[model samples]
Target: MFSTLNWFGWALLSALFAALTAIFAKLGVAQINSDLATLIRTAIVFVLLCLYVAGTRQWSNPLALSGHSWLFLGLSGLATGASWLCYFRALQLGNAAQVAPIDKFSLVLVVIFAVLFLGERPSLREWCGIALIAGGVMVLAFKEQG
Candidate 1:
């Protein structure tokens, strides 16, 4: 079913879901502890993912995973947890419009990390786009103080 869609299509869907997540999370976090909110969200995600893996019969034994895979995946989970905590706190303390854009500054960092760590070379056009995104994040994240 997904064969016809390319990476860009998937990325667009991700962007749509991410935008919805920000709006929904902002509303949900109101009048609650941000950390508790994040925990609830994480629990929901964990259950859903577990169901998905079970339904798909894609569960792999932990022992089957290589050490490198375990290490990297563990690190990724830690990073995700930290990111979610920070994102939820930011949402609680700020407007979704501002917080989401600042969170998206990750795009710039991803580009740089891809080049340096993954040895993936982006074209000059892509670099320009990255720079533009960074600039836009700065513009969106900062407001003039009266």
Candidate 2:
């Protein structure tokens, strides 16, 4: 599926999914605690991912990955777990409308990291997007005057 679109399209789709998640989670978390909510969501995702891999028979290709691949995959899992932990804590502390915008600010971090570590150069358009994202996060952090 990801093979079909360009990077811009993929980024847009990811942003849309993130926004949908924030909206749904904000509604759902109003009734349930974040830990329980995280557990339930993680369980559902685990089942779905397991079934998808099983259906695709990707489990049979274990030797295709190198040791370095496994190492990176493990690190990726750790990063994901940390992100989930912090995200739930943020949701518990504030409205998702506010939290989600701050979370979206990670793109600016990504831009910095990519330039430093990956030696990837962002185009002018991407810089514009990052600037707008930073501005949005600043606006989200401030209280609305009456």
Candidate 3:
């Protein structure tokens, strides 16, 4: 059923949710410590994902996963936790408008990593898009002092 949707469609949904996450997280962290807020948010995500897997009857698949999958998934989880910690702290200290765009500068890094590690070949147009994203990040992250 999901085969009809391409990567761009799924990525668009991810981007939309990411934008909402920053807004909600900023509001949530306003009265609390950002680290505590991230903990709560992570707990919520953990429960929701558990429920999703159980509801989908996907519980049995984990045992079938290879060692490599487990290792990489664990690393990914660690990366996510670190990112959330930093992101929440950044949001606490800065405007969401400024912080979110800078956070998304990861896109430029993703393009480079994909090429270097994944051995994926991107076309000239994709490289240009990555450059544009980098430029936009620089423009957005720059603050002019009066």
Candidate 4:
């Protein structure tokens, strides 16, 4: 099943799950401190991923990985943790509709960071779509609540 799809399929699934996460986390944060809630969420993800890797026989020696891989993956993990913590806190204090779109402002940042740091060159069409995302987020951020 997983073999049939390429990146776009996986990205669509990720977006669906992420939307659910915002809704669920908002409800969960109501019952506990946001920081503690993030910790608990992180723990669940860790254990589930462990089981998934073990069940799939995908485990390998971490020491076998290159220093660059370790460095980048470690930094990515830190970034993910920070993002989750902040996302949970935002859900605790704001409407999911608003917070989720603003959170997606990261999409614009990703495109810019890719150009500057990763030497990526998105086509004009891609730039237009990215601009739309940025504009949509701004609209969501500033729209009057009637």
Candidate 4 weakest ten by summed lDDT: 136-145
lDDT of each: 0.96, 0.84, 0.93, 0.95
Segments in model 1 whose C-alpha atoms lie over 4 Å from true places: 1-3
Q: Over 4 Å off in model 3, which ranges?
A: 1-4
Whole-model lDDT for model 2 versus the true structure? Answer: 0.84
Tens-place lDDT per residue, model 2, 83-139, is 876787688778887898788788899899999999999999999998998998999
lDDT of 3 at 137: 89
Show the lowest summed lDDT stretch of 10 residues, model 1.
1-10
In every candidate, how many clashes are there?
0, 0, 0, 0
* TM-scores for candidates 1 onward, in order: 0.94, 0.82, 0.92, 0.96
Candidate ordering by lDDT (highest first): 1, 4, 3, 2
Q: Write down the RMSD of all candidates, one decimal each.
A: 1.3, 2.5, 1.7, 1.2
Q: Tens digits of per-residue lDDT for model 3 on 14-111?
A: 99999999999999999999999999999999999999999988788687899999999999999999999999999999999899999999998888
In model 2, the Cα lDDT at residue 67 comes to: 95
Superposed by TM-score, candidate 1 places the C-alpha of residue 61 at a distance from the truth, in angstroms, of 1.5
lDDT tens digits, residues 23-51, model 1?
99999999899999999999999999999
